[model samples]
Target: MAEVKASMAGNVWKLMVSEGDSVDASQDVVILESMKMEIPIAAEVSGTVKELKVKEEDFVNEGDVIAVVE
Candidate 1:
């Protein structure tokens, strides 16, 4: 399994993939809003999304796990 982590502290703006969705390495799975900018968080490995550790509008810190893939 792979854990997708936040690259920076931010509010989760949107979710691009849901549970059971397939994702590729480097695929953008979530958008985070911070510092008046939108940042996309990508999956680190190709796999099916197993869980979402965060929800839209939730705040996350840098390096926080946002999703799990397997």
Candidate 2:
């Protein structure tokens, strides 16, 4: 399993993938909004999305797990 984590403290702006979705390595799984900038959080491995730990508009800290891929 791989954990897609937040790159920085921010509000989750969008979810690019949902549970049971397929993802490739380096594919954007989430977009975070911080200081008016949009940052993409990517999956580190190619796999099916197993879970989403955050939702759009949710606040997250750097290093927080956003999704699980397996």
Candidate 3:
């Protein structure tokens, strides 16, 4: 399994996939809004998305797991 974690504290601005979607490494999976920048949360490994831990407009912190892939 692989975890998709937030890089910094931010609001979840977008979610690009749902459970069961296949993804590739470095794919833009989520967009986090912080410090006036749209920081993208990317997949670390290629696999099917298994879970999403945050929703749009949800606040998240650095290192928080935003999704799980397997």
Candidate 4:
């Protein structure tokens, strides 16, 4: 399983993929808003999304696990 982690502290602006969605490496799975900017959190590997750890508008810290893929 691959854990999708936050690169910086931010609020989850949007969830681009839901659980069970198929994704390719480097696909943007979530959007984060920080410092008045929108940042995309990308998948590092091709796989199906197993779980979503954060919901839209949720606050997340740097290194927080946002999702799990398998």
Candidate 5:
């Protein structure tokens, strides 16, 4: 399993994948809004999405787990 983590503190602007979705390595899974910019969080490994640790508009700090893939 692989855990996708946020790269910076921000509000989750969007989720690009849902549970059970298949994704490739480096695929953007979440978008974070901070400092008037949108940052995309990508999957580190290719796999099926197992869980989403955050929802849209949720605040997360740097390195916070955003999703799980297996």
Candidate 6:
């Protein structure tokens, strides 16, 4: 399994993939808003998304697991 983690503290701006969705390596899974900028978090491995740990507008800290792919 691969964990998609938040790179910085921010509010989740959008979710690009849902649970059970297929994702490719380096595909953006979530977008975070911080400091008026949008930061995209990508999947590091190609697989199906097993879980979505955060939803849109949810706050997350750096290193928080945003999704699980496997």
| RMSD list, candidates in order | 0.4, 0.4, 0.6, 0.4, 0.4, 0.3
- Candidate 3, residues 1-70, lDDT tens digits: the string is 9999999999999999998999999998999999899998899999999999999999999999999999
Kindly report the root-mean-square deviation of model 2 from the true structure over all alpha carbons: 0.4
Q: Indicate the residue-level lDDT of 35 in model 3.
A: 86
Compared with the true structure, all predictions reach lDDT values of: 0.98, 0.94, 0.95, 0.98, 0.98, 0.97
Question: How many Å off is the CA of 12 in candidate 5?
Answer: 0.2
Question: Judged by TM-score relative to the true structure, which candidate is superior, 3 or 5?
Answer: 5
The TM-score between candidate 4 and the true structure equals 0.98
TM-score of each: 0.98, 0.98, 0.97, 0.98, 0.98, 0.99
Tens-digit lDDT string for candidate 2 (1-70): 8888888999999999999999999999999999999999889999999999998999999999999999
Residue 6 in candidate 5, Cα distance off native in Å: 0.5
lDDT ranking of the models: 1, 5, 4, 6, 3, 2
Off by over 4 Å in 5: none
Pairs that clash in candidate 4: none
**Tens digits of lDDT, candidate 5, 1-70:** 9999999999999999999999999999999999999999999999999999999999999999999999
Candidate 6 TM-score over all chains jointly: 0.99
RMSD of 3: 0.6
Give candidate 4 misplaced runs (Cα > 4 Å).
none
| lDDT (Cα, tens digit) per residue for candidate 6, span 1-70 | 9899999999999999999999999999999999999999999999999999999999999999999999
Off by over 4 Å in 6: none
lDDT score of residue 35 within candidate 1: 95
